[model samples]
Target: MDSISSRIQEVTPSLTLAVTNQAKAMLARGEEVYGLAGGEPEVDTPDHIKAAAMLAIQEGKTKYTAAGGIPELRSALSEKFAADNNLEYAANQICVTAGAKMACFNAILAVVEEGDEVIIPTPYWVSYPEMVRIAGGKPVLVETKESNGWKMTAEQFEDAMTPATKMVILNSPGNPTGAIYTEQELRDIGEVALSEDIVILSDEIYEKLVYGENKHVSIASLSKDLYDLTITVNGFSKAYSMTGWRLGYTAAPKPLAEAIEKIQNHSVSNATSFCQYGAVAALKGNQGFISDLRDEYDVKRQFVLSRLKAINNIRVVEPKGAFYFFVYTGQLGLKSMNLTDKLLSRYKVAAVPGIAFGYDEGIRLSYCTTLDVLNEGLTRFEQFCREH
Candidate 1:
């Protein structure tokens, strides 16, 4: 008899993927799907980035270059960290991985040990705790209040600490909720992490998608000490609409960076070669497409927010970044899975169950599709809520 490893067995398959795949299957069967469950931008990759990748292929730059990343791309990332986030990292201090998801997993695997605790706030991106578990670390989830905009307070961070606490994961302009941590709030959390000597894994993949007066702040940039304690993870997937490109990176203190690179060396080796060239182009080329996409998302976000507000029996805090809304469906008197199942099966709308994000009272809806789909999906969703 064969058996799966306990670590792998303990992990739950990503429900976000499950929902998206189901929606895709329905669409494949010629059923109309609103397709509000995906986490990717529904746009073509910018032409210049594609041209750069094609150029790399033409130049035969397709062979494996480095486990961490190609030097040129890493150097480009070094400048990106400085110019965009106000954090300084030499090329050697960065490790490029297959995607931001892998960058996160590599950082966790490098540091977390058995019995160590990793604090994760509630309504987090569904992957964080699972990554910690795979690394043999206990994920200590601290429930955050909805009234506080679903953000964990610094006091809450300190309260969650134990002698066994080894790390804390922070996602800003976060997934599911789209909550952006303010600069002062980051300072307060940094102070707590500093006092406890906890490693910070800051996921800022949604950094470039913020709206209005809200700005994305890298927690590592708050202070030198915080920078030393942080492994900042970011990627091109969200910002550049390059999800299929499979590129992202981690910038850490020297030792931590070395360990993450070692893990990368043993695992998926390197991100795709020509894609690295594309990422370089994504970094160095024209940035207007990002703003244009953001402007479109902002319009969809407002339309969804207004529609959700008009619906009875649900509540939603406005998301200032990223492209999702974690709408509270508690008053509809169904758990997220049930609500989402009914929405998909009966109303032809697909959404991620918020239970996947550790919040059973809500469901996450992505506004990454066209306004026409948004209008139709929200109309059906409103009908579903009313009947329930």
Candidate 2:
């Protein structure tokens, strides 16, 4: 048999998936693992959203619609951008795909030719660098150390740019650390990206999930130059608790979006027709449900942040948004993977190793579980830290 492509070999398995699977296998053997490694909300899709999908399917809305998106959904999503985000996207500039991840992949493939460079900030989404490599481009990662709450500075961004830079991937309400970028900070990065002539792929998947006083900002809204150069990749999964629906959309400059649409034409054809209808409901229907969910996440966030702070050997930057807390567990004299193992084996607590998210000596604990269960998981985290 022929060997698979070298590109496939170069891409490492997602560390988060590997750790999650190992913990899952242990649970299958009857171990009581708390499994705080997942990045999703444990909450179910809202009843109204579910009802909408059922209605669509029953109405025989299962056939292929359009490559870009159904007109109704695009129009609704466009209105959503204007209503919620203060951004305008006509139907021509929009294309809906499988999920935000696929939208990101589409953006990368659209812009990244072989050997080109894409600058990714460290403590980034676990998949960004790997996806860049898979698309035959180099991933240029710049560090955002813990002291700065894992944020990229204007100077750091300046140092990472070069003539060959094709794109910069920005993730706010960032995964693992839960660091939400402010509008002023995005304006600074937007300035850098525009000056460098690099395309910006702003991944706003966590836009609606922010907590406390932090607000999610779109980098494209910083200026007209940015609006023309930015590919805004967002989806219904994180915001609407609709991960299983697998619908995401991107609004980009017309010429750039043309390339992404072509790729979508050949690869996946179109997102499920029924799901698109459901997404319309998610976008235009009562959105107070999201706020209700965010309120619960805030309670859990404060609880986990406070509990993790009291531990002696571990240091965690309190997450400002999203549902993650990245804990620096290096002082325990154990690498993060080993620490994860010990935590699972001894305390039956499952947390992803920090190395999974590009930082060694730390671990990511998700607070997306229930109020009672979230507290119990933190107690297990404390037990694991103390015993080590």
lDDT of each: 0.94, 0.87
**Regions of model 1 farther than 4 Å from truth:** none
What is the lDDT for 162 in model 1? 97
Candidate 2: give its CA RMSD in angstroms.
1.3
Per-residue CA lDDT of candidate 2, range 1-388, in tens?
Answer: 2588888788888888887888889889987778798877788988888888899999999899889989999899888888878888888789999999899999999999899999998888889998999999999989898898888887898899888899998888888888888888888888888897889999888888887777888888778899988999999887788888899999988998899999999999999998898988887789898999899888888888788889988888878888898888889899888888888778888889877778788888888887776777788888767877
TM-score of each: 0.99, 0.97
Best by TM-score: 1
- Whole-model lDDT, candidate 1? 0.94
| Model 2: lowest-lDDT 10 consecutive positions | 1-10
Give the per-residue lDDT digits (tens) of candidate 1, residues 283-329.
Answer: 99989999999999999999999999998789999998999999999
Candidate 1 accuracy as TM-score: 0.99
- CA lDDT, candidate 2, residue 143: 84
